[model samples]
Target: MSARTFLRIAVSNTLVKNIARYVMMMLLALLLFGIILLATGKDPFQSYRDMFGATFGSAYGFSEVLVAMIPMLITALAVALPSRVGLINVGGEGQLYIGAAFATWGALTFKDQPAWVLLPLMALLGMIGGALWAFIPGYLKSIGLVNETITTLLMNSIAPKIVGFLIFGFWHSPMDTVKTENFVSAARLPTFFNTRVHLGFVIALVLLALFWIIMKYTRWGLEMRAIGGNPQAARRNGIPLKGYLIVIMCLGGAIAGLAGMSHVSGFYGVLILNFSMGLGFMGFLICWLAGGDPIGIFLMSFVVAIITTGGNFLQLTQGLPYAVINILLALALFVVLASPKFFEGKKA
Candidate 1:
């Protein structure tokens, strides 16, 4: 066979393999969901119908899903960026909490300030707070050979506690609630179309585009990819391994921090104890599902947002459990991880 013929055959085979893998993943998820429904004595098809209707049936539902996607997109980028440097950033949860805490503090401190002055300061402080939280693990890994995965995960637990302390102790409102005072009107994020969808959605999109450019075109991105692919080789090529690790981890934390800020300023308008609600872990899953691709992450974040939003609908309208959504996400991750053959075909 000619070289051209061989290339064509190889490409076709790879495409076939990817299609098979995706089909199998979907089938497995559906099967598992059906089994769960059977165990619960619920009609799987009816439950699915209600879920779809709730999330995508109305403009308000769709807008709420988009609102949820804003944070997921930013936080997923946090995980994706660090992954490119061969680092696992499980600290997004903690980073997000700390970021929001800082942003809230900034807002409360400068309550009399104008919107233009306070909002940017809140965002900057939030990023710094998240970066500092993430820096702890990065510093440990760089200096002491500590596992970042463990450190980052531990930080997640610590972060909410710190936020709780602030709300329950220092920043607690006089109304006897476990939440801080609402942000000043000037500090709240502006919305569009009189919907819950805020400027944060636009920011997430712009960041996604910027990240795509950095990952595809920049020398730093090339170096990060090289490091992720082969740390020893990257070091041999003089990629400044320690510095890159620290910087990338910080960058990831900063993005997550921005998510926390956006959540507070745009959605809640206040810092609360459970503001994060496992978004960091969800972001990690989104990164895995997207295989750390920026565009893939952006799309998958919306998919996840739909699942979560629809799952809530299922619970309220169909009497199905919300945990079903988590099961589906886990199944999808399991299928992807187990299908090494799918990835191998792509390499061919």
Candidate 2:
């Protein structure tokens, strides 16, 4: 056979296999979800209808879904970027909390400043906070051979405790709430068309586009991908592994910090304990589902947002437990990890 013909055949087979794998994963997840519903004496079809209707049936529902997608998109990029350099960054949760705290501090300290000044200042502080939190893990990994996953996860636990202490002690209001005072008007992110959908949504989209370009065309991105593919080869090529690891990890943390700031500035306008609501972890799943493709991350983040928004309807109307939504998400991750056979081409 000719070389060109063999190459074409190989590419076609690979494409077909990938398509089959994705379809199988989806089908398996749905099947498992249906089984759970049946075991609980509920109709899966009706539940699905309710879920979809609540998320997409009205403009308002769709708007809420978009609101939910903003932070997910940013935080997903946090995970995806570092993953390209063969690093697992699980500390987005901690980074996010610290980011929010720093942003809140800026807002409170500069309450009388103009929007142009205060907003940017808050964002910078948030990024710095997140990057610092991420840097510790990166530095330890580079210097002491510590596992980034464990350090980052441990940081996640520590960040909330710090926030709790601040809100419950120093920043606490006499109103008996564990949340800080509301941010000034100038500190709040602007909305689009006077809707609840804030500027953070647009920011997430811009970051997605920016990262896509960087990953596809930039030299740095190429180096990161090479390192991910083979560390020994990257080292042989004279790539500075330690420097790249720390830089990429810090960049990821900065993105997650932006997510935290967005949540406070655009959604809550106040710093509260546990305000993240597991969005950082959801971002991890988004990265896994997207396979580290920026565009795929954008699309999958929205899909997860739909599920989250729909889950609220499941609770309010159908009286279903919120755990059902968690089960659905877990099933999705399971199927993606378990269905590799569909991606395998026929052997000779």
Candidate 3:
């Protein structure tokens, strides 16, 4: 075959294989969740039915899922961006915290400013906060021979405490309510429906297109793919390995920062330590389940968002414990992680 034809075939084959693998992983996860429910003396099918009804059966319920989608989707983007450069940033939680902290401070600091200036400025601060958090570990990996995983994870532990400190020390609102004060209207994301869902959903969708273009069409994206796929080869080909690494880490951090900002400004409007609540981990899971395709990330995030919505319904409507939802998710990720090895048999 001609070179162009061969390239097309190769890309097509990769897409098909990834899709098949994703489907198998999802099926296995469902089976595992079912097994867990059985062991717990509950009806798996009934629980799943209840969950499904919450996400699809009612407008109010479905809308809540959309509201939840903003942060999870953004966090997934954060993790996926780092993975593009072959780094495991398990510190998404920390980056998220710092981002939210900066965003809250920015909005409050400039509450008197117009939305056009204040909003973008806060978002900028958030991205910068996230990048700064990621940059330290990226630097260590690039020059100091330190392990990125350990440094990143350590940061995660420190970030929440910082948030708590701010809450009790300086951020405690002057208002009667105990929580942080509501953010200025300038910082809030505009919503579409009367529901809590906001424009961050639009931002996530726009980002998918932007991600594809940046990764495939831009010089920077090519460098990231090169380093991620084969750093040694990239270096041999005269790519600036350190430059690419820094750029990739910064982009990843910035995206994650935006995630924290989205959660606070768009959803919570305050810097709550509970603002994280495992969202960083959820983002990591979404990236894995998406097979690193942006569109796939969007779709998988929506599904998980639905599952979360369903989990809430199970607790509220059916008197099921909320922990059951997490148990199901853990089961799902475990099954998925095991499937590639199980399906490694040679095709006939």
lDDT of 3 at 317: 62
lDDT of 3 by residue, 104-161 (tens): 8998899999888987888899999999998998999888588888988898888888
Candidate 1 contains a number of clashing pairs equal to 0
Candidates arranged by lDDT, highest first: 2, 1, 3
TM-score of each: 0.88, 0.88, 0.87
Spell out the clash pairs found in candidate 1: none
Prediction 1 global C-alpha lDDT: 0.84
Better of 2 and 3 by lDDT: 2
For lDDT, candidate 1 versus 3, the one ahead is 1
Across 143-169, the per-residue lDDT of candidate 1 in tens digits comes to: 757999999999899999999998998
> Each prediction's Cα lDDT score?
0.84, 0.84, 0.79
Candidate 2 pairs with clashing backbones: none
Clashes of each: 0, 0, 0
Q: 1-348, model 2: which lDDT tens digit per residue?
A: 589986896688666666566667767877898899889888888888888898889888889899989989999888988988888998889999999999999998899999999999999999998999999999998775799999999999999999999888888666856888888899999987656899999888899898878876899878888888887799799999889889989988988998999999999998988888788888987786777676567767776787778888888877888867888777877876664343242100
- Candidate 2 has an lDDT of 0.84
